[model samples]
Target: MNYFIFGGSGFIGTHLINYLKENKAGSKIYNLDIIENTHNGKSIFINCDVKSEINLNIPVSENDIIFNFAAIHVTPGHPDYDYFETNIKGAENITAFAEKFNVKKILFTSSIAPYGASEEMKMETTTPMPNTPYGISKLVAEKTHMIWQAKKNQQRQLTILRPGVVFGKGENGNFTRLYWSIKRHRFFYPGRKDTIKASIYVKELVRFMVFRIENKNIDIEIFNCTYEPAFTIEEISNSMMEITGMQRKIYKIPAGILKIAAGIIGAFGGKSIGIHPDRVKKLMISTNVSGKKMKTSGYNFHYTFDQALDDWFKDNNKEYLS
Candidate 1:
């Protein structure tokens, strides 16, 4: 099988490459990213922006699977316009080219951001009230894929995946952030450590995506691709402690106080505030996502938040720590 993927150098993309190499052997995977090479063997890196490569000049065929996993994601301070152009325009070009190239399946990695800041576990069917331009752009990107797929009809299939905060070995995502902070003893849970923050490990996410690719016969395909049971920041913190034998005092300040503090920061630096005031607000709130669709679609999560954190780090030689 020929699989063409965009953004294989970063967190999610790299994990997907690992999956393809380890599990999808004998398959040729083309990784398209703007940066220079980040992987080795059986894969070729295309040092071109996803938007630029949308010309369908690359070797995409009707038999190939195209995955769009590229985006300009910078939380807490990314400009709204850059977020829109990269996330929205990137999606537009990818989907358009997928149509033109007659790609068999297009898998788009979106975010739980589209579901807004939630106080409960969100389902795939839940109504989305995107809190930030990033969230709005992600939702728009997912729609663009659908629109293109409909136009191309049977020739193309589109699968949209909304994974919770994705974590992996050496990831800058929530898990590693908490780990590093805990290692430094600066990690604190502002509201409550027990707030159910939705997350999935990178390996598990790639596993689910691979599961989908191998078994596309299933219908009802949109998935909230996180670990089945959600993990609270407290649970995650505790898990980290178990893994690293690390411990730190966790402080819980009132959410109101944090809001006031953020307001002060916003006054001093508007752009420094984040995509929205509630970016942190959303994280503090419970936003667990169930992987019911992924499970029913023959995909299963390989790690609990605890297991995913503990087991992978044993390979200390790996560069995920960097």
Candidate 2:
């Protein structure tokens, strides 16, 4: 099958490319993104910006898959307007491009942000109350894809995956920062250790996406994509220590002190320290998202959180220590 990926240079996209090559999943893969080439010469790269109007230049055919992973998703990184401009506009253009070629399937990697910051377990059917510009933009992007699918009627298939925090090799996100802190013996919990962090391994996430693609059914479908048994920060830290063989004194600082520190650091523009007040606040909240749809679909997960971390450490521990 011919595959086209938008934002194919980003973390998850890079992993997907590697997965396809390792599994020999596609005959021809076209990677579309604004970033310069990051793939291993396995994909044909087209330096196209999804926010801009341009031809994707991909030879379209029936049963072709268009995977949209493009978005300005880093919280507190870009301005609010940029999120809507890139995410919403990117979805708009991708759907239009798919329509132009009559692409058979379009798989979208959305986020759990649409449900907003939650302390309770969130389901796929939860009423989205997006509280941030990023969340609002992602929710709108999902709607845009649905609109395109509606136009296709029974002729096209769509899979919208709202994934939780995706982490693995080469992923520089919250989870990675945690690893760094543990490695340096500076790991600490601001208050409690039971804050649920919903997450999925990048490889496992791509595998699930590919599974859905190969078993495509003609319908507009959506699924919450994350590993089962939502893990707490304590659980993750314990796993990290076990895998990396690193022991650090886990400090339990008062939440109030950390909150004040976060505010002062954020006011001074200290995101470099990974201590924005907003982010610190979010860390206290549990994003216990449920992926029951994926589980009930009869597809067993390849890696639990522990297994995923083991694979990541096996591949990256040498570089991680340096």
Top candidate when judged by TM-score against the true structure: 2
lDDT of 1 at 266: 66
Best by lDDT: 2
Worst 10 contiguous positions by lDDT, candidate 2: 313-322
Deviating ranges (above 4 Å) for candidate 2: 267-269, 317-322
Each prediction's RMSD over C-alphas, in Å, is: 3.2, 1.6
Candidate 2, TM-score vs. the true structure? 0.95
Clashing residue pairs in candidate 2 are: none
In angstroms, how far off is 167's CA in candidate 2?
0.7
Provide TM-scores for the models.
0.88, 0.95
**Residue pairs with backbone overlap in model 1:** 170-320
Q: What are the per-residue Cα lDDT tens digits for candidate 1 across 1-322?
A: 6888887777888878877888778888888888855577857877757665465355667778888889987665577888898888888888777767766688889988898776766888999899889899999988888788777565566778998877766575556656776677655576777788767777888887877766645222578876667777788787777777765777787878776776676677743314135555755778777776676775555777667776667655432332
lDDT by residue for model 2 over 1-322, one digit each (tens)?
7889899988888888888888865478888998866676878899999987758554679778889999999997789999999999999999998888888799999999999987878898889989999999999999999999899778888899999888888788888888887877656687988999888888889999999978748888888887777788999899877877777778888888888987987789777877688888888888889978888887888887888888888887545621
